[model samples]
Target: MGIDYRGLRDPNAEYTMRDLAAESMGVTADRGGGRDVEITDVQTTMVDGNFPWTLVRVYTDAGIVGTGEAYWGAGAPELIERMAPFLVGENPLDIDRLTEHLIQRMSGEGSIGGVTVTAISGIEIALHDITGKILEVPAYQLLGGKYRDAVRVYCDCHTETEGGAGPPDGKPTGEDPPAADPIAVAEEAERVVSDLGYDALKFDLDVPSGHEKDRANRHLRNAEIAHKKAIVEAVTEAVGHRADVAFDCHWSFSGDSAKRLARALEQYDVWWLEDPVPPENHDVQREVTRSTSTPIAAGENVYRTHGQRRLLEEGAVDIVAPDLPKVGGMRETVKIADLADLYYVPVAMHNVSSPVATVASVHVGAAISNALAVEFHSYELDWWDDLVSETVIEEGYIEVPEQPGLGVTLDMDAVEAHMVEGEELFDEV
Candidate 1:
């Protein structure tokens, strides 16, 4: 006997697009966060995704890309094992279901940090990538249609400087150097401006102007007022009025610290003060906003709009930056954008990693109505796009091709060549 149509036969239809999406993709599981999920594979490949220490790509027979973002020092493969069974045969396209399942695994601890999200973010990206390929459209189209064609790129070229001077000569602190004085940064900014013929630079404000100056004021001692102001003064002075320079504070500040620094550095004509005082402390962020004229922006550390709505509603920032990969890949980032749109808050997709993320951010940048800019640290790194199937940056702008999926296919050969120690295709993470 066939099943009865309980309410459908009543002739009163109550359904929305969400029901359709849910029905199409369907929800089958809602596992909690972190578990003893063991790894079948420990794949590690270095692309442009954040710091290149190799990423663990956990896969299933379903052909999903669970790109695990293992932190600087943390084991993730083991967690993957505890969660794998709950996900086996579960539909990858059903993002809502997957999110719920992952949330469940997150358990009573109120959720986990790097491992849980990294696993979720990876699976989400693979599923979306598959969906884009299936639909013969880019992932952004799935998130929403294109809102802009080209994404603006901000060169994150870093260099060392001394005492409010300019970028120093010689190799950049040997490929990647620890923090340097403000003068070293200024000289490097000049080189990019004059020699490289580029504008839009990104500088991390961490070095203090001087020890004496810092010790003179308790407020400026650690992650201080002097350091930020010094970096800003040097970079802007060297780049002049022509270039767009953004300071990435990396969420290393207290409310008072950011406010004091923002107020002092306002003269540098900062394009934006980013991730100041962490993603939490929205109240402190609001206080900072109230105190300074600089347009405060934060979100790289933020996940989806679910948590972001609070910060946006509170008017804590002028710009919202959702790191595409970090916030459950592309779709969630778009969801973040939609919410940001309602609040009249402009969004800027954060592309912290390689081409997969960059391509996804491109689509979001193109489709988001209130998108202001797209972040990029890729161009600054060595052979940043070498692993990508396709990448193009022209005149400080990146254009997304109207191709299927993300318009990118990871160079598997290259990935394999650099795969960490013992991961094989069927290694089973």
Candidate 2:
């Protein structure tokens, strides 16, 4: 004797028939009137390009799927697979619980930082994508709504025509390419600012300018420092006040050398000097920041909030640049930003993945008032926007979409065309 469906729909009741039907027909638990949406499977693939792009897909019982990407590196796919078993059967909407569960479960596997955390970040972002879709709201809403309609973007311009060549291991190509050398870099910066409308840009300053810097000890010769200064001078002169410029050393200098370089570049009114020295020692970075009037940015290689918290609390850096997808997905990044906000520190996201991760970072930057800017690493990749259904960047800003989830779908043709050697698109194990 099953209950009669016809009698269950009382016209006088507060809830609608569709809502009641959704609950009685498919809802898994009594926690809410919504469907449970349990995780069914997780999949990953590596696509080669400037760097290997590690993409993750999470499937649920309700037939909804969420996509995300991890930072390019070895063993992240394997790490995601290792963490997938714990996520199976859990509610996709229980994002915080699930994120903490994965982190706690992988604590033994060195989840404190490195590849393990990166793998979790991919899954965590996918969970946000899933949650946003299930709730029928934009991802920014889950982060407590947005502070701005569009997120400001900063281009990572280089002096090279990278897009004209054949795809590197089948990675996507770009439209117009920018080229190297101080003069060439300055020209490219002017073109990107005036033509592309990018108001902010960064360049790699570690390349030797016909001067030998001790590579082994990370020591800069006087000539090397002067040459680097010359490049900055040329770029600053080119852009004038149209754009804010920052130079990246990629942790290529010793503390003494980094201090020397930072002081020399202060005259250019640079945005910030990035990762001039190794980030392992906070005291060293603090000393460098204290010694320079120019702002110091670091922490892209650091892991989670715990990893970056010390740097902020101890006054180690003026700008905190955490690689969102690699550090800890959306929610964690928001938490990281909030923590930094308390210390009066501005967040500048360090990005190097595909559109999936880049847009994810945009949603995060939109939610946090302390976010200064998000990095655009694929300016020269002509097909960078083709990987997604539509272009997200217009002019120099990423317009936040009002659509549910991440607001973009993967272009399967583009993805499959650039899939890494011997990989499949979310193929089940």
Alpha-carbon lDDT of model 1: 0.61
Across 1-429, the per-residue lDDT of candidate 2 in tens digits comes to 323232222334556453555467665323233456678888998877678999999998788899899888999999998887777656788788778778887889998899988999999889988989999998999999999999999999887621222222333344222323678778998999999999999988877454542356677889878878888998999999999998898887889999999999888879999999988989999999999998999989899999998899999999999998899889889999999999999999999989999999999998999998899998888888888897799999999878898887888878888889999876532
Cα-based TM-score, every candidate: 0.75, 0.87
- Candidate topping lDDT: 2
CA lDDT, candidate 2, residue 152: 91
**Clashes per model (N, Cα, C within 3 A):** 45, 8
Over 4 Å off in model 2, which ranges?
Answer: 1-34, 161-180, 427-429
